[model samples]
Target: MSLPVHLAPSLTGVAPGETVEVTGDEAHHAVAVRRLRVGETVVLTDGAGTSVTGPVGSTGKRVFTVRVDDVRREPRPQPELVVVQALPKGDRGELAVEVLTEVGVALVVPWAAARSVAVWKGERAERSRAKWQATAREAAKQARRSWLPEVAALARTAEVVDLVAGADLALVLHEGADDALVHVDVPSAGRIVLVVGPEGGLSEAEVAALVGAGARSVRLGDEVLRTSTAGVVAAAAVLARTPRWG
Candidate 1:
């Protein structure tokens, strides 16, 4: 089995044989919940590309120490995947964030689309965004990712259009679109963006705006998918064709 991974703020300059202290809620979970004990092996990451493998040296009520045995630094993956997911009703937002993180999406933007049923306002907006961020954090650890995916602040449609305009390749998943995602040429490097609309679907104006901003409307397949699942399915399909998946 793979070693359990814990997050650290920053692993800069960490070296083998050095003692690293892990505290806060992260340490509490590792100690009280995961039952991490002295001499147990674990992996610690700064969630920005640095990871250290070590054995537990000591444990306390809310903190633990690990004697680093090895340190590895990974460069950020090329052809970064960015997804703009329209707000889905209920808990499906978190589900989308979790699966997207697991599949290696570099960033997720929660979009407040015109046809979206769920609305984020005031406290609800902050709370909802926090949930997505927290979900990404846990999911990245579960996926053994050294670079954690970012859950960007909720984006307005105009902001999303700018993002689409800036990407090397941008796709909007539209059920009515004639172009198939597989046929699109994904760039070997640089940013690729995908936009998934909500259950109510994207309004005609929204589609036009994004496409006008340089995004190509494409479809995954004949079968329709849930709002929460389409982004991940499309992402996995696209990533599989890129060198990053190879």
Candidate 2:
């Protein structure tokens, strides 16, 4: 695949017009790297559920013009999926963000659970959050997503509880839980949040806290999944059930 199309800040205020220039990095990539020609068409996304099909008009260092041939706005997802994932071990935490963003998660919240091995405290915390945000951006480009999933600040158990409580449906994925992921009734609130624990999993008290916060304890299957894999799985399953995606 070639470098993903990027939206210029100018495109933010309006929809795609007959002519739009993809400047800066996207222009450089198309001109100096991808070597796109004048007639070749490329997809430009505004990262807000809007996409435009346009052909290259001119290419230069900071000037890449593409005349819009057509434009389409995908119907926004009905139930916005937010994944609250506990920080994984080592670089696995970064990997989680990449995969979940590609999976079309609307939001990513880093949970600093009690069992989390990768602690993000003070300076390390800021750096880790920045890296995760970057990973989400790159993954969004790779996945050709029209909207970027947000990477929120590192959160503790209580903070995560608050975030989940804001959702229409909150699910806690745990092995000790008796309920299966399929058992939860999908709500019509247009938003669902999944809470995934760290490598060592959530403590018993933490589970209680989330449950108290109205998060239903849901299990994947019989097998346990790694911290990095569980969120992706849970998101896919929930998305599969949504009518808009189906």
lDDT of 2 by residue, 50-79 (tens): 777777887778678878777777766678
- List model 1 lDDT by residue over 144-191, tens digit each: 999999999999999999999999999999999999999999998999
* Model 2 TM-score, all chains together: 0.90
lDDT to native, each model: 0.97, 0.83
- Candidate that would win on lDDT: 1
Clashing pairs in 2: 47-146
TM-score of each: 0.99, 0.90
TM-score between candidate 1 and the true structure? 0.99
Error of 2 at 133 (Å): 2.0
